[model samples]
Target: MKRPNGEKNISSTITLYADDGREFKQTFTIPLKANTPPPKPGYAVAKTTGTPAYYVLCITVPDMDKTAGEGFA
Candidate 1:
């Protein structure tokens, strides 16, 4: 599947299909925050002065795929 991209925060679930036909469900969200400044010639990494964004992932195992309130695995 294509990766999602945007300036807004995202929170949703997605399904993944394995090569062996093992279908699995997973939920993931990417938070959109301020853009960090680009690194200069001497900088090894770009520094972020603002709040950092985050990613949340919740995967459902094969055995418990049908359980209710099964958030993160």
Candidate 2:
């Protein structure tokens, strides 16, 4: 899905789908803070400057495929 680009900050969820028709739901918390690069490039990298939480859930399916452009397995 296409996202809106503007000066206003917005927080949304991003879902990553697998080729097996399984999807992983993740809620993203975006911070409306200033963007700054660290002294070192690889030191820190984030969509925005804030704390982000991540949770992983297990999905049991028969087959799993990780091919690009392929809809499902």
Candidate 3:
């Protein structure tokens, strides 16, 4: 999530099921850096490489029309 017209990489996919029907899949790659300054009770970003990596959920809407709330306060 980089502004100034650039940067934004985020890919994700998680599915797991078991109960007579088995299924498992996991993949994630999150790298959004715009100097990392967008956190107001919300923040996330992680991408380490396989073997053991986590923290994929993210939310960084710097302006997005005031985080989609419209009348931002």
The regions of model 1 sitting more than 4 angstroms off are 1-7, 10-12, 33-73
Off by over 4 Å in 2: 1-7, 28-73
lDDT of 3 by residue, 1-73 (tens): 4355334334445566778677756544554545443445567787767878766767765454554345753
Which candidate has the highest TM-score of all?
A: 2
In terms of lDDT, which candidate is stronger, 2 or 3? 3
**TM-scores, in order shown?**
0.21, 0.24, 0.21
For model 1, state the Cα shift of residue 54 in Å: 46
In order, candidate lDDTs are 0.49, 0.49, 0.56
Q: Candidate 3: what lDDT? A: 0.56
Alpha-carbon runs more than 4 Å astray in model 3: 1-6, 24-37, 40-73
lDDT score at residue 53, model 2, on the 0-100 scale: 52
> Candidate 1's C-alpha lDDT?
0.49
44-70 per-residue lDDT for model 2 (tens digits): 332544467544444444334445475
| Residue pairs of candidate 1 with colliding backbone atoms | none
Clash counts per candidate, in order, are 0, 1, 0
RMSD of 2: 20.8
Looking at candidate 1, the ten consecutive residues that score lowest on lDDT are 36-45
